[model samples]
Target: MENQNLNKILSGEKLSIDEEMVPGTIHLVDLEGTLNVKKESGSQSNIILQPQPSSNPNDPLRWPKRKKLAQFSLLWFWAFMQAVAVNWSGPIWTLWTETFDCTYMQLNISSAICFIFLGIGCVFLQPTAMKMGRRFVYLGCTIIAIVSNIIGSQGNSVQVLYVVNLLSGFAAAPVDSLVEISTTDVFYQHERASYLAWFILALYAGSDLGPVACGYIVETLSWRWCYYIQIIIFGVLLIVQLFYMEDTTFERIDRDDLEDKIIQQMKSRETILSAVQSGQLSQERVNSDEKLNAIVSVNNSINTDDDDESVDSSIPMRTYWQKMRLVETEYNDSRSWLTIFYRPFFLISFPAVIWGGVVYGSQMMWLSLLATTQSEIYSLPPYNFTTPQVGLTNFGALIGSLFGMAYGGPFVDWITIKLSKRNNGILEPEFRLWTMIVPTIFNAAGLLAYGLGAAYEAHWFVSAGIGQWLLGFAMSSSGAICLTYSVDSYPKLASEGLVLMLFIRNCIGCGFTFAIQPWLTRNGLKVTTWLMFMLSIIINGSFVVLIKWGKDFRRATKNNYYKYSDPMFGELFKK
Candidate 1:
């Protein structure tokens, strides 16, 4: 019966059990521990590596642990600095209004312009990254950051501030999209969530901690010093990246070719299982690493295309000079730059991607709320906190984000495996949604506590410590969950999906920043707080909808997914 099921799957039959399963629904868990496949070593021996590493020695997946870590750390730090440069102005906005002789609304518009460009930049830069190389985009953005900061440090007028923000937002755009894609390049699916959470933490740390540092800098020295210090740090970073950073972008077999190999391998594995069940071969032979490697080698030779001349064993590892090249021209994609730019807009049609956007965008709305209102609320009346004091309050959100990083990443990965085991080893993308309950509850309560606590003049801790902490937890965790869910549901389209999701998130954030002041002015803090609380429940609670029907949504899009996943999709589009 098990053999029959495997055969049916190989033949592309939609078995009853797989009616709602689609491209992303994977057989992830090895429940009985008898599966013959390549898997993670040590305690995670049963966990298979998704998109199993190619035999090519230079595959990022085949890189040494230390090498992968080095690449990740450099990218992570770049993302952190970009977030810091974009957000460092929030704490000093009051100082800026006085310094530039502008109104709070003018500063708010400047911030809004930053977000608009952030969204536009994601759409624009991603194509360049795809066409040139991620390394090219990363290096170019670093230069932009350095130049933007230099201008900012010397700026005397509001218009100069606008130019600074425009460049800063554009430079910061990759933090929202490409960093996540680069992460996926170096890590496998099982280990990705934790690092995705780390990416979120980097953003939060910079956005949260940058202002904390800005407060002290402005109070002691001057606002110009913030830009001056960033200029120095970015300069050092540019030099390090030029020598050390390796482009993760690599060309690999597409969806159909990978699926063919998987089908053939599964058939071979099933034959071995059948032999064991019939007492034709001993279990010890099945468990031997030598036996599995022999079988895998045979399968690879059988599956290799006739036209491909290069043997897997003959592929050489990349040299130090090759790795540090400014552009990965060897792996250049054949797709047109316009096609890459337009793909993300097309992905907005995917339900899971759209839902992921809403979930993540809601977090952005909350983040914008805190960013916009912190000074206004904390500086006046009950709190009457000084500049540095207001900046210090972000520490609560920072702490909350730390806990959120743990819960959203490794914890979710662990839970997904456990649940997959229970469901007969079939891992549905919807399994990722089950943990969304934690963030949903955290988000609603955090909004209420932060907003109502501030409205009623509660203790500083009530609003800052408890409320901001809860908000921070929900922001990071929920962002990770939804982003992971969308990517997992359409693994082939991960880059475009992320671009669309961030586009939506930044647009929402931009609009919220524009409206928050007016809304507060019209409704006062109490009403606005209640409305936002209700809004939080509606937005975050949406995980319930996805958890229940997400599989059906994936199933519905299967044909569309296959069509779009094609590497020649650009040519087809033109025709």
Candidate 2:
């Protein structure tokens, strides 16, 4: 904004950019004398990227280390609880069928219904969080969890359980749609991949971890104890949330406000310096020159520590108490979602969004199908594993997830930093896509192993257990990579894009859950898995196409995003 030519570009006026500038490249730093973002790396540059926090110490990006951890932990636990509601039931099907006098198919249909409503619920819940306040949604979702769990524990009829589960699914939706957005609201660009990965970790752990407990409870105590455990967890989280889950939703673009203040101060300093040099003001009349000179001397000497302290003393900060408020300012009229809910659907035309959704949703659908298949397999035939052992099978997934959590999240961060440096910090979204190959290979392997082993009546551990760990690793890694790519590339539309992905993924999940039984029974596990391997290969291999043409896709969208879309939405992305 301080540079005249760049200001022209930001103001909707075209200045012919240099030939070196590409469609996918971002101009990260604006400091004078700093190295330009270019196509090759050499010497290191001492500059931070833009869209950074204001000096107003209240900015969440500027928050202290401990506060960041605490805030992230709170959202993570809530997300965990939401996911638990969906998968905890995986272990209780036997109890449910016996207690409610229903068939497995009925429970399958109910699960499918829950999946559908999970997306449906997000359609409303997401926009509410976007428009109203995150605090309100967090509180409401917690209350819903408490109430739904209570109802689930008491419900004895199939219809009643279905209703309770549907409500539970609804309550879980915000954790999906809001957590990423909320995390982005607080964390910086460099930290986003790690934090977002943790969110995915929480989600996967919540779903995968619950069956372990559910199996033991249903076998020893009662199936109702699953709901009781959820209630206790939610009760603790609810109390913590009342005090800790500060509203992270605000126009962080308020850096424009902060920048404007800085510019005004700069002009005053220039004026004072000019007066001092020109002798318009005597030495007795002004002390501003001495302060300005001290700042200049420190900068010239490269005493970075003194420079930071001096700048910190000059910059304004928001108080600790003020940062805790639920809403910082009146809602911007432009943020109104009267038409913004449809924005993500429009973004579906982008290749990055499509490929990411494919990699993510396909794996998610595969996982969902296995929950039923794994349970049904071990319950019968040569294995006849006890409920506790059935729960233990999830340990395979948990182990894989732990590995993915450890590997995928940090790997993306490391590779991105390396790639960014290699590219002279001129990042393209495709840099993140390289690591996705790991997931692609394993996605196919997992499906094939699980399906064939089961079809041939191979050992349960060989078929279901080992294969789940591989599939779980693939699913977790792919989900983290794709989502991090989408957000890094087009942060303004990330929430909408993610919601669209969720909606599609869940729809696919519902379809797969509905078909898995018939598919397995008719085609046998070997053939069904063979088809899955082929599909996984096709879906994951397509990442090559994105890597090749992703920049073009991003270019196309940038050209049309503001020009063809609603100005209200368009303006939100203005540089």
Candidate 3:
């Protein structure tokens, strides 16, 4: 009987089950009036009554809070290590130029090559993660990074260094996108900004810390020791990850239970038919049974429908593979890769990204330039500071980063959640931008101070302190606002948006770092600082326009922005 019912359900026939059947038992019987026998069970019918599909307790989000923290920590640590490795090459750029007898342009090309590969890595790593899973991809990339660092350290030729730099950038690509994605996967929306902020803090902190640590090493030991430091950190991170980070893959829900329920209903109908053929029961009895069975079957169907709905709603519509191939026709037909890449350019084209590019890129440029230039400017007569002392200038940026991390992450998150609640569970990605106001003012002030301080050759400490606070605040707020807004505005295309931002930001940073030195030497720091200040004013001032009219903008270009399609978009825009 069970076999017949199972087969019937598998074949797409609906079955009705009794409400009083024994638990875990499949009952096959005829409905009181029906001419066919079908499977009916009270307990099996109840399976559909549950509201949600059971989540695996082993899932990363279900892991203990302490475990989640540990995972987050490990991610931050690896990010920091990668950041350090990137800038470690900065302090040693002069050394490489002198040793290899390469021109400044060639030396800059080495760093630029690393950054270019970083962007290329971003494009491929996300796709790789979808196939092999995030854990495997992260581990593989870190290991490759470790090996590249060691090889680069041992290389004696400029060509070898360039090749190693490119490879290292490729290997470290996962650290950028994967970490951000993983953080979002494991944490709730409210907690994401804070966690992301922490991640960025570690990233910038490494930039500051890397040069200082490597400068001392390069001065006392060989430039090769700088790469050695990265290898050691990578080794430590690799072990930490193996034990702590678990795969956060979304589970596939099974439909076998639904199939089985359908089978049981079929068997009940078959039983009724057989009884009629055998004349074991009168027509009256069969009719009564049929009515009872119909009621039970309807109830069972409802339960099954409920279960299916719950399961469907809990899982996101797009899976990892679908997201991986969003641009490819093999995955979706709505749009092409070229379309996806160019869409944002046409949509928001707000000077926000351009300004963000300037803010972030210029900071990196100035930091690198200042590190090398300080020695020539201040080390000779009055200060006579060594390479390590010059590296200490990074202390301001470091201090500012710490302060930004503490304030930006939790504060932005709290404000977003509070604003979301007042708005009735609807979140406008614009709420995240509110916190940027202060950071903008600070950033503008910092640029003005750093540029003027350098121009006047004022107290070194004054310039460092101003630069630190400004860049620090700007990094924290601008980064937080840009990411949050991108995610909220284009949740479906969040990854693509991130890729665009990353590419623009890195390219700008690389450009400025290469050009700032020459520009400052030719134009003077005062002139350059004013240029940055004016840029910030224009960029920061746009926020007023956006905050006041952003919703109108979103509504005007409904096709361009996904936030418009969201049910909450209309209501939220009213506020």
lDDT of 3 at 288: 74
Give one digit per residue, the lDDT tens place, for model 2 in 204-282. 8887888888889888888888889889989998888877777776654442322233233334444544655767655
| Predicted candidate 3 versus true structure: per-residue lDDT over 1-575, tens digit per residue | 64554345335555555543211112112223221222211334122211122333333444455767977887788888887777665556656667887765666666667777777777666655544567767778789889889888888777877788788778767655667777765664556678888888877788788878877987899888888878888888888666655655433233244224544545565665565576754556645764534623333343222133323345454444543431223212123234333443442353333444444544455455554454455445555566677667777888888888776788887786666656643456667778878877887887777767766877777677776667766766566666656555544444555656666666766676567667767887688779878877776556666577655554454454434223223232232
State, as a TM-score between 0 and 1, how close model 2 is to the true structure: 0.82
Worst 10 residues of 3 by lDDT: 22-31
Q: Clashes in candidate 2: how many?
A: 0
Looking at model 2, report the run of 10 residues with the lowest lDDT sum.
34-43
Lowest lDDT 10-residue stretch of candidate 1 = 299-308
lDDT per residue (tens digit) for residues 1-575 in model 1: 66665445445563333233386788775554544444564534366667666666667776777888988988989999999998877777777778899977888788888999999999999888887889999999999999999999999989898899899999999999999998888787877788999999999889899989989998899889999999999999999999988888887854343434444555556655676688865677656756444443331232211112233768766788988888778776668788888888877679999998888988888888888888888888978888898898899899999999999999988888888888877778888888888888888888888888889999989888999999889898888888999999999999999999999999998998888888988999889988988898888888888788888888888898888888667553463
Off by over 4 Å in 3: 1-59, 251-382, 560-575
Q: lDDT rank, highest first?
A: 1, 2, 3
Give the C-alpha miss distance for residue 503 in model 2, angstroms: 1.8
Give the TM-scores of the predictions, in the order they appear.
Answer: 0.90, 0.82, 0.69
When 1 and 2 are scored with lDDT, the better candidate is 1
Of 2 and 3, which scores higher on TM-score? Answer: 2
Q: Write down the RMSD of all candidates, one decimal each.
A: 4.9, 7.3, 14.5
